[model samples]
Target: MKAAIIGAGPAGLAAAEVLSEAGVAVTVLDRMPSPARKLLMAGRGGLNLTHTEPLDLFLSRYGAARARLEPAVRAFPPEAIRTWCGGLGQETFAGSSGRVFPRAMKAAPLLRAWLARLGERKVTLLSRHAWAGWDAAGGLLFNRPDPEPLVLRPDATLLALGGASWPRLGSDGGWAPLLAARGVALAPFAPANSGILIPWSAHLRDRFAGTPLKRIALSFGGRTVRGEAVITAAGLEGGAVYALSAAIRDAVAAEGEAVVTLDLRPDMTADEVARRVAAPRRGQSLSNHLRRHLALPPAVIGLLREGEAPPETAIKGLKLRVTGVAGLERAISSAGGIRLEELDEHYAFRRLPGVFAAGEMLDWEAPTGGHLLTACFATGRAAARGMLRAMVG
Candidate 1:
């Protein structure tokens, strides 16, 4: 059977691999000039293929969609990802943070190897083909630049168009309107792993923009995440900020703003901080005392000055008033998409049979590190299995 996989991101590529292995003729189509642009970008920062955390904790990271995505993830868990990477001759290693990466620490090698494997399987990759939804006759139509549009009818189709983030890279969320018109239920897209826009003063913004706050703990809505965050000109961005993004994003949506508490010295206890602050000034200025005793940098001290003077314990709970989340353009991933209920157990659309979806295009969001990539691979494989079952059975 002939299968068409759209978007060519992690999800679509994973699905293509599965379908091709099942003796199906797979053609992976993408709008861009090449495939897996985002994946290449992700590899720049060391491609986090998956996490080495325990299964239960790893599954819990998907939040409410855990139950919906669990089956696929379980069927092809983190171990499977490492095995698959090994199959591609990419040795996998877990960092101290439990994030798995290829020994090469780059995406190019893995991607090149993967493409070679796909090529060996005769899985066709047709780039620069922009999907323009279905034609009047229910045939798939694509917008080719040469003015002559192309149309085809495959036995099955998988739309893994990704989410609204990194639109310039290909996943522009342009497919949402098309799918919605087909009576598919959709959740409005929102920034998932994105920064929060805090209205910092001109001085801080000018001086501290791009400053990295290391060994910090951020808390919001009773959840605490410890990691590093960078002070962007727009606001806060990085792993810690991303971990709190969902909570802060929801609060901002519901209440117009959200307050997050940042612990500059997360390794120290509240009492320890209080003791350090209570030490004699010894003719030192407040800034000097903070720097000397607490070892806080000038940027962190600037943040402290933004708030009212409080007890030493309060220093550990410095509040940041977040205005809104960064837009999808700046987001690493996106939350919300085709709602889970709209799809069946096989990741096939209930309203549109013979069609399947996977990856960030679905209504699930997870923190960065490796969860996102893991789920993408899992769902993509699952969607292909679904398609194969439908075709065979």
Candidate 2:
């Protein structure tokens, strides 16, 4: 059987591996000149493949989509991902944060090994082939630099076009219109794991922009995440801010703005902070006092003084108003795609049989630290298995 997988990303390539191993002739197409551009970009800062957290806690990261994605994740979990990486001759290690990364800490090596393996399996990879809906004859259409679009009719197809984030890296949500025209149900795409926009004072914006706020805790909507965030000219971005981004985004949508409380010294209690700040200043400036007594950095001190809260309250919980979230172009990933209800248990579209989808194109969102990548790999494998079953039956 011949299978065509669109989007040469983590999901599409993963599905190609599964189908080719099952003796299916798989052809993977991508709009970009090369495959896995986003993956390589993610590798710039240690490629996090998966998380080693307990299964229940890890699954809870998906939030509303947990039930829908649990099966695939359970079948092929983090351990499996590590094993697959090892098979490619890339040993894996878990960081202190429980995030897994290849020993080389770069995606290029893993991807190179993976592509070589796929090539050995006879999987055909066609680059610069952008999917352009379908023809009246029910054949897939792809646009190229040439005048005429390329058309193909594979026995089965998997659409793994990623979500509408990092468009420059190839996932531009261009496929949304194509699927919607076919009467497929879709959810509006929104930014996920994105930075929050805060109206920083001119002083902070000019002086502290690009400063890193390390060892901090951010709390919003009853959720607290301990990590580090970097101060941008417009607002904050980093793992800590990203963890609470979804909740903050939803709150901003419901309300005019969302308030995130930042704990500058997360290791200390409210009383401890109050006691430290109450220490005799001895004519030292407040900033110097904070620096000397509380060990707070200049950025944190600036943030604390930005709000109207008292020193004690500010140290324990300084509230910042989040005006909005970064757009898809700046987001690490995207939320909302083909809603899960449109697909059956097999990941195949109920209305468009033989055409399956997996990856960020699905209506689910998760934080950073490997949940996103792990789900992409899991769903791709699951969708491939479903396609194989459909072909047999």
Candidate 3:
């Protein structure tokens, strides 16, 4: 069987590997001059491969689409990913937060090794060929540099063009209009794993514009996460905010604004915080008191002052209103895409047969720190299996 996989990111790569292993001839295609530009960017901060938590808890990260996603995840899990990496000669280690990373801890090395193995397995890699819509027979059409176009007739084709977030890296929702033109229903892509915009006082913005808020607690819609966040002149960014991004995005869409409260110190209770603040302050200023008493970081202190300078007791529990969320251009990943209703359990387009979709291109969103990559890999493998089954049947 011959297969063509589009978008050479994690999903497409995984699909290629699975099909090749199953003795199916595979050709992977990418529009970019290089494959997996987003993957390489994800690795800039150590390339989180997967999480190390228990299966149930880790799976919970997928949220509303857990039922749809669990099957694929069970098929190719974190352990499977780790094993795959090990085979690529990249050993993985779990960080303090239980997130997994390769020993090399970089995307380039792993991608290079992976491409080498794919070459060894005889999977063809086609780069610098942008995929146009399918032909009348649903055959893949490509636009090469300064050429008319090339038509590829594969036994099966998988579209993993990714969601719209970083258009520069090539997963621009550019595929949406193409698929929609073919009657494929697609949800409007919105930003996920992105920051929110909170108007900060000019005074505070000047001091803490680019500061990091370490070890704080952020709460939204009954969900709480303990992580570090960075304060930008425009708003909040970092792991903590991204954790609550989905909820924040939904809430913002529903209402004009959303209010998210930060414990700023979840490790301490109201009483504890009150006690800490009540500590005798003889000569030190309020800023000094907060800095020395609560051991608040300079950024947090500056942020608190920016919003409102409350009485010592009032500082125990603070409230902040979030006006809006960051835009798609600044988001790490996008949320909405082709809904699961468009595809069957096999990740194959129910209406468009002999074609499959995988990865961020599918309708599901998760935070950073491996959830994104994990789901992409799992769905790609599942889609490949679907293609293999179709070929045999």
Each model's total of backbone clashes: 0, 0, 0
Which sequence of candidate numbers ranks them by lDDT, best first? 2, 1, 3
Using all chains and alpha carbons, the TM-scores for the candidates as numbered come to 0.97, 0.98, 0.96
> Per-residue alpha-carbon lDDT of model 2 for 1-393, expressed as tens digits?
999999899999999999999999999999899999999999998999999999999999999999999999999999999999999999999999999999999999999999999999999999999998889999999998789999989989999999999999999998998889889989999999999999999999999999999899999989899999999998999999999899899899999898999888999888888888889999998889999988988888889877778654688889888999999999999998899999988899999978999999999999999999999999999999998998878
For model 1, residues 178-258, the per-residue Cα lDDT tens digits are: 998999999999999999999998888999998999899999999899999999898899999998898899999999999
Strongest candidate by lDDT = 2
Runs with alpha carbons beyond 4 Å of true place in candidate 2: none
Looking at model 1, the pairs that clash are none
As for lDDT, the candidate ahead, 1 or 2, is: 2
What C-alpha lDDT, on a 0 to 100 scale, does residue 185 get in candidate 2? 87
Residue 374 lDDT in candidate 2: 98
Candidate 1: C-alpha lDDT:
0.92
Return the clash pairs for model 2, or none: none
Give the candidates in order of TM-score, highest first. 2, 1, 3
Residue-level lDDT for 275 in candidate 1: 89
